[model samples]
Target: MKNWNQQEVEILKSKGGVIALANPYDNLVTTGVEPWPPAEVVQKLYQSRQTRAFSEEEKEKLQKFNGYYSDFQSIHSEDAITWSVFGTIARAQIEKRNKFISELFQTLDLESEAVESSEIYLWRRIPHPDNLVPSGPEIDFGILTNDTLVLGEAKWKSSLGAAQGKNKDKNQIQLRVEFLQKYAPKLYPGVHNFVVLSVGLNNDVTENYTGKTVKCISTTWGAICCLQSHPHHDELQRYLAWKIKNTKNG
Candidate 1:
């Protein structure tokens, strides 16, 4: 595979940002793949099933299964391209765990003491804090070290939510930190939250973590895309380039 030059990366950062981080259904459409059944169709099907439900157990199972399916579709659809990029990087990290993570941390400008082993886990849908809250928000990506828990939310052509409301309540990142302090003490004692955007023109990606509330650092998908330039990642690089080219042409 040809080496990716700065020019190519810049082009991708500009024209291919949307394609690189497109929703799964949109990705398929961009690539000329067939669209899924419409939202109304799926809703109608679910409603019909609900109208002729079976026993309590069966109904519970149906609802659960439907929810699971919805989540599956969402995960696959919403962040398909972003996941593709991260998934390839994860695979490479598995091969060169220590080196890969060290470089990755540096790329993201993460300062750490020391970690014996690290793990990268994706698609974390943290449970709600209390019964009052029906559902909890999700962490787009996570990196777990021996003592540190780094969670990141990635955005493309969208602004990160700084605060939930004008009243100045905790922001989304702060809420996650609060949850970790309350619930995930044993799992991840230390937490770091970051947000990666497609265009990080004026965004702050610096370390702003303090106390139990970690300030979210903003970065760009293009910066992380640079990590996939290794020879071992040739296949993924080629694939991404090919897709980006197609997307641009279209």
Candidate 2:
């Protein structure tokens, strides 16, 4: 249902060919699915907050408010164009909270009871190590339990490295771990890392690059809608392949 692009082709090759993804639905047959919430509820919670097109007035507001875009008119950036992707990430947390956060943990084989008891958090601001005002990388979403923690970063069409950037000690994931260690030492050493992205990346790349420090999962509009929408294995495989082939960062 989707057309292939260069990035998708490359990602497929990187992941040992497209054969496995070719029929991803096969794996979905056994995946358990909870019924989705009603349409109105979903609309209220997850609807995109972006205007269909960026109008002159909206551009002026962004230029005035978002410092990052102050010079947007003078200098063009593809990244800037996609900045609103964060809206998708926020909506995902608000609407598909359970499916994206809790269900994903279950899919990853995290402890059932712990995941069931997990709470989702959106870290828009990070406090300094000294417990000062928020002053660090902004994390997207997190799932926390008494002993287990899952840190997540969301992106629409960017790789984890691109989205996270290169920060030595202030990395978002590192910040989260350090925060828990400093405040709630009990949750230390119980960290599980995740990246929710809609781009041309595979688990193999994620595991190899991070040395398995984090688990990478795909999302739609920054939500884990692939497996959640597929009640049958066949549909899962098809939709997954489609998503992988379509979502290119550039």
Candidate 2 lDDT over 1-250, as tens digits, reads: 2222222321121121212121211112122322433222222222123322345444344333222222212111112112222222223433444444456656655543433334555444555544545565555555565445555555433344433323343444444445544554433455444332222233321322232433344434323334452233243344345544443334
Instruction: Please give the CA lDDT of all the candidate structures.
Output: 0.44, 0.36
Off by over 4 Å in 1: 1-78, 92-95, 129-134, 161-171, 181-187, 190-215, 228-250
The whole-model C-alpha lDDT of candidate 1 against the native structure comes to 0.44
Which of the numbered candidates is closest to the native, going by highest TM-score?
A: 1
Alpha-carbon deviation at 109 in model 1, angstroms: 2.5
Candidate 1 lDDT, 1-250, residue by residue in tens: 1222322321112222222211112232122112444332243223322213234433344344334222112211324444445543444444465555666667667675455676765566676543226356566667676555666665533355664523456566655666665666644545443322122323553335556334345665445546644323544354445544543232
Structural similarity to truth (TM-score) of each candidate: 0.52, 0.40
Clashing pairs in 2: 24-237, 25-233, 25-237, 29-233
Worst 10 residues of 2 by lDDT: 9-18
Candidate 2 wrongly placed segments (more than 4 Å)? 1-102, 114-118, 129-133, 145-147, 156-170, 186-201, 204-223, 229-250
Query: How badly does each model clash, as a count of residue pairs?
Result: 1, 4
